[model samples]
Target chain A: MKRIRMIALVAAGTVVASALSACSGGSEDGGKDGSDGPVTVSVMEFQQSRIDAVAKLIPGFEADMKKQGKDIKVKLVADPLTDDQFKTKVTQQLIAKQAPDLIDIGDSLVPGWAGAGYLAPLDDYLKGWDGWDHYYPHIKKAMVRQDGKIYALVHDTGVQNLFYRKDQLTQFGIDTAQPATWDDLISRLEQIKQKTGGTPIVIPAGTAWGGSTWTEGFQPILGGTDKNYYSLETGKWDLKSPGFRAVFDLYHTMYSKGLLPVQDLENPNPWEPTKYVKFPEGKIQVSAQGTSGWKFDWGPQGKAPIKGLNEKVDTWQYPGLRSGDAPFGWSGLGFGYGIPASSPNKDAAMLLAQYLSTGKPLADQLVSSGAASPRDDLADVKPYADEPKLLQAGKDLATSVYVPTGDGAEQVAQAVAAATELIINGKADGAQAYDAFLKNATDLLGPTLVKE
Target chain B: MTTIAATASAAAGPTGQASPKRRRRRTWPVVLLLLGPAALLIVVFILAPAVYGAYLSLTNTQLTGFAARDPQFVGVDNYTYLLSNSEFLASLGRTGEFVLYSAIIGQTVLGMTAAVLLARPWVRGKGLVGAAILMPMVVPEVVASLAWASVLSNNSAGTLNRLTGLFGADATDWLQVVPLASVVVVNIWRGIAFAMIMFQAALEDVPGELIEAARMDGATALQIFRFVTLPLIRGPVFLYLLLTTISTIGAFGLVYFLTQGGPGGRTTISAIYIYERALQFSQIGIGSAASMILLALVLVLGLVYVRLAKVEV
Candidate 1:
């Protein structure tokens, strides 16, 4: 009985010890950095390699700051969360008052965070910075809130294009030249599908992130205006608008006529390289993909699985459904850096944000990293200017209309996703889906719904 | 008789009554000393958090930004909304179906077969087979999910599709078409090992003499197993049933990594639905309410298991 009692006591003691250890571990690590130490700047960097490149350049920044009599030390960190996880984590941290000094906020999240007072107003910083003038007007407009305050810097923007196999299009007797209208593209898709017995166009409709292909790739053509889905001038949701309805009908007609890859839409795996791999192998004809695919997934940079695919690949502006006008594409300053409102070192944080946004180091890094810089001053940078495909993409982005950022943006996007899902699943006809989407938009936007 | 008993008690009572009461009072301190830390830890960690979660569930307690600005007393609004939400209802149905098929049927049948095979004296390398079968339980959940995903990939390059192609069968999107079944298979693969090990231990505890006696009575192997072996291992089987049911209900990682409750919510279990609602959509109030409902269900199931199936050692 005594032996059993001793064993039970030891087991209980171990459990207590483990519980105490678990509780104390977190606090102990935090307290190890004594007070009055260097200001720790936690940053959620989306790009790991970019963060590493920034880290390498930090010593120079620190040296420059020291020469200016600032004793601040810099610490760059990278903890990438997926799109959904990033939203949830950043929101949670903001509410808990535990947000990092700097965060990479998506363009879609700017209005929501700004309205919630999680972002610090960057208007004062922008006024003093000359590089603000170099930002394309539409990109700058995208960062501005309804209250007329800039909350973020446009870092990198991407352009959507109709990527097709030149050989495949030629074989099907379809023109490789820019499509005159949405109908022209659809007709070509039908021709390609019929001639080759292969899928024509593949759009990602499996997950929420992939669902953006419709909103980003196709909606601009349908809506006609640069201000496609959201109208900033009118402060209204555009779903009920004629242009939006036309786009939905066009997409539905395309789906019904088998001009789209119907099987892969419902398949869970996103149709990225999997869809395009077939295209290069002569099994698929056309796909809607971002411009980066030219260099990253198709060219010599890509391995044997997708090698030499870019040699036969070409791109054109997504065609407009409305006759007599070019389809105004939707563009936004992709993702940018913002200082948290609750940061202890707000000025220093702003300085870091500026350093990343407009400074020479950032431009140099972008040039070396082969990424496009948002600043027009760096527009002539060799890597971006010399790359033929990237140059075209950059020019397109500079000229495109940006999706508006404000009060009903998130809700409108969600409604659009639901409508697209209905269209893809064949649950609702094109007109019905468009009407349902508009109704949802009107409910979300309330007074913001535009008349006529 | 009372007078004689009173005389005998009068002689004995004065010697011990006060001392016995004093000794009982002294033992209370030792009891507190032994159980004090454990009770404190439980109250602080498990019980406190559970109570706090319940309180938060009652309020409109969102986890972020403006939603946390002024959390209002919403009462049962969240619960009412979730009860009506088609998505949540579908997820509950899916989870119930998964638990029934994977945990109940898969684990029981596979575990019982392994137990029966291992119990046989003629079986060679029984320990090796047990270890080999139990390997999946040791593999990390993420790694296992990735392995299953690779096999279920819709691409023609995937292993299962490649094998099917050899037999002149068309490649099908296995995960997309049969998401629930894929997740169910993955869950069963990870979970069956535990059930098998438990049942195997229970089967070893059954007396060999009884089986030998049954065999002497001209009973076949199936008859001996049904009448003698099964009854002996009833305790472990009951314990495993309860454990497997609860675990399967809470299964998340495999489904999340492999299917992500996709192809139109076919694979969405209750846990995945709660995650999507709370974390993805930032609808914490609804998520908390659904969680509380799940807790209630688990508690009821647990009580029933204890009452009807528990074997007191």
Candidate 2:
């Protein structure tokens, strides 16, 4: 009887230990070096095409490894989660100490994620990397964290272009050249609306488009004002600034005058009809969109392919609020890979990130997805040489303003989205929306954080 | 297993009768030994996490940034934040609306109606009707949501829009125009089968004679149902109400996958709000505080159901 009881206690202890070990998922291997053996480095990827893009690049990394007599296999973890879910998944995995070796995240997310110690600082790796200085100056600036340490690599950079149907502009007899000011852009849009009898310009808005409502819609206009939400000097979100009101007023002006697509912004996926269907079918003649739309939305392989894209479509640099003010929009950033500090194989992970960032692999992303290279010598790249529009957008990256990224950035973006949503619904004009933005910003970040 | 009889017997070597104190002593260790593994599992898996969550609610912990690295204790601050959060408060109200419309009114009524119809001996195509009613229960939540997303999506090509077009009704963005109602309806669609199954088992045990006796007393059909059938199935009804209400309040995946609390926060129920705060927005402290509030609400409701209805379980 005593023997049996002892055995039962031993058995129960074993079960509990086993259960906990199973839950651990080898978290003790946080710094385990798998260099001597066959090592698999998992990467978190959210899109199939982008995953396929990485799949194409993995062979190069592994073959290069094989040349050095090391074995490394890449595993792509497919996540088709929503944007918020994508953040949540990575955050949870990082907290649980089960993160994949590499995280493919937006350039904006790099600061916050790295600040939490979820990502490894790449500054040590950059010291020996030959390709560190090859990226464009802006891309290089974006790679360094506010703490003056490198956190990520810029994969490929692109800018938001103020694109219009050249043929439609010709028919309307409106100037096809870059709009010199907000008034010029609005007048051109009004002219297009008068001729076409439909909404001519679309800047994405509302919560349905998620972060894009702020990033692509509101912040672009705010960028034209030459003031940003986060002030680096004081380190406070600028709520009472005129730049805040200016962006809202611009939204109110366009929306109240029926120049914007208010109805489509309420759709389940706001960008679908506006970017894919209406734009390609010539229902809307002018819009600001990422340069990736060249391959992802209007090229031959695009969902709604526009015929004669090169000749038919033309783009202008984003113009300022007033005439002769320098052009600015929320552009000049790139999405890329980062290594989790908890990763067992940091060396292999950085190798994969570097391999994906430079040379033929980087050029292929441009041809395949129109993810223009962040390299300073992008003009010499074969893919950029073949595409003039991409070349122009690449050159324009020199002047674009990348959104400052850090801890409170996401909350600030949410505030802008809320403000724009009010304007989109016609619930508030510029002043009222700015009031709403201020209130929401204070609510999100607390009273002490938000300032004039 | 039985008080470790060998030890007890060895100790009882001289005495013919075991002392009451020794017997009491032996029984407790045996009882504790019996309950040990189960209690250990509960502490490790359930209670510990729940207590930790309660502790988390009082802190300034977040999913990222400075707060994540060094969470500071801020007693009741998280609770105050959640209470003042307009979005969080509105989400609670929306959850109440969902519970009332989707579970209390919609599922119960529709499920009872189907069960009553199927209970009738003269009902035709009973198997077909039963199968159709139960089909949704077998469909995965995501697959059902995907199908409904396509059906209720905007554009003329949507299934429901195509159907309504035949009547000259203009295509409407169903999810946006009536966001709450759309989610309530989808939730109702998914939840009806559970209520139906519960009611069917319940209605089967309702003695036919009592219902017949009520009818024989010149009671109308409605009166017979009100006095006879309802009272007989009261236990299961109360049980189902308790389960359905709690489950609906806690529901996230079905409605989340379908709408994600969108189209101007119309469908932002408590679950979605909790998820948004904790994970998406990375306000773990506030999320945990809100979760405690939700837990309290569920507890109060559960107690009310049991005490008011005089429920057995």
Candidate 3:
């Protein structure tokens, strides 16, 4: 019995020892290199397919680097995550000081990231590069910080426009020509709603993507103000300003007048196929969408998916309130690439960013891949010039005016969402909702009045 | 001398049988041996981590930049901050509501009714019914959540809405319009099987003779059940209730995939709040404080149930 007990104790001790040893081994293996390996680049999962195309340019890039005898190998890590997950993951990595070497920062998040000191200043890289001269001034301004540092290079730009069904508009006795003003667009929608029992317009209001309605829809009205919504030039909030209140009132009126689908405001479906798909099928009439809408919504099962969609579907600018005074919409650059401060291979990452943004790579790969190039050198690129709709979109983004940076743009967005909810639910009238919105905006952004 | 030693050794017939006291003394080593693994596990995995977590809960620690960025000892500031946040308070309320409606009322009621019906000998294929009832419990929570989400989808093409459309009713956005109800329904469906299995096992242990005797004494079926069968299974019922309550409080996946705490914070529960604060907002200190509070709440509730129910092994 004594011998058996000893054997059992030995066996149990071995099991315990093995388990503890295994855990220790795992930690040691993970921490072994201590950041002394080939420099790895982190790219968004959305750009994974583009990485291969980028890899083809690496031979020339590496040959240039080898002349300097850096002897560094580059590896790309693609983090394909949805918007929310991507933000959360990137934020956590930044907070943890484990951020990927290269990050594809969307335009909306660039300001916040730069403010947080998570991005590196790219002034040194930009100064020597001739590509900087070719970039649009507004695109350059969007990427630069107040501290006189460029944090990101613009990778792609997109345009947003009002997409309408030509047949449906003609049926409602409305002009299919470009809208010149907000009132003209509203009148067209009102006519459609009166003539057709179907929803006149579909706006995504449930998800963040739905929030783009305000971006493409209301920003134009707000941008037309003398000081804009929030004047970066003045560094002050203009909450009580006429331009701000007018835009809020416009949103309230559009929602209250039954022009857009109220049910879609809280529709849980992230991508409401019914809205875009049904519009093309003659079930729904019109939509405000991005350039990608051609491929995503209008082509196959899109508005005129029945074979001649390109001819039947029409794209137009918002009409001006009066003759010859077209109200130009606000346009902003979309997303871009940047080197993270935590990157191990800054030189290689910088080269990759430059290569992707300049010359044949810029015009051939980036633009041909359905994105607009930031460089003016590629302004007359073939695919964009040949495609009429894409050409129109490119022009809109190039020439359109933009709103002055708003004070707390994110907070303003939240207020708009709350106001939309109230209007959709009929808890408050349009004027009342607009008032509440103005109050929230002023409270969050401080009062500096502007009116229409 | 040799003969005397031989006689003395022979007197001790066997070592263990030599004396009762000696045998009793040897049992201490056996007890210690038996408890060694459990004690070691408690010290390494449970007690040590718990102590570490408590230390972390008192400090404000962020995860980046300087290696020597010392953590500040904030005392109860984190807790105070969390309690003051309206979002956190709303989440607590939502969690409490979920636990009450879904776990306590829905699961318990449905589980008991199913158990009672299955317990009857006249119910054909009782074994098959029991297996079918337990099927949902065996499925991973995520898969169950996905299944429920599809069935209760807000779109017109969703299973439930499509079925309802056949009856000439308009489709309803189940998740968006009624976020809380959506989570509650899914939770009840997911958790009912667990309660049912527990109740079935408990009911099986109840003495049929006692119930039959009560019925023979001019008692109705309901009266017999209320008086005799219920008291016998009270312990198991209490156990199931405690388990279900605790599980419901920490429920994450079901609500996460279903409503995502959206249509404006209506379905945001305490678990999701902790996740967003810690992972999304990078507020580790606040998240840790919330976790500690949750732990305390669960512990206190467990203690109260134990005291009130007086459950026997």
DockQ winner among the candidates?
A: 2
> Residue B176 of candidate 3: its Cα lDDT?
72
Residue pairs clashing, model 1: none
Strongest candidate by lDDT: 2
lDDT of 2 by residue, A271-301 (tens): 7788888888888888788887787678887
Better of 1 and 3 by TM-score: 1
* DockQ (0 to 1) for model 3: 0.18
TM-score of chain A of 3: 0.78
TM-score of each: 0.84, 0.92, 0.78
Q: Residue A229 error for model 3, in Å?
A: 4.1
Off by over 4 Å in 2: A1-18, A26-35, A322-324, A447-452, B1-45
Among all windows of 10 consecutive residues in model 3 chain A, the one with the lowest summed lDDT is A25-34
* Model 1: how far residue A345 lies from native, Å: 3.6
Candidate number with the higher TM-score (2 or 3): 2
Tens digit of lDDT per residue, candidate 3, span A164-268? 778767876788877667777788788877887656776544222333434555554455543445655554555555555555556666777887666554554
DockQ rank order: 2, 1, 3
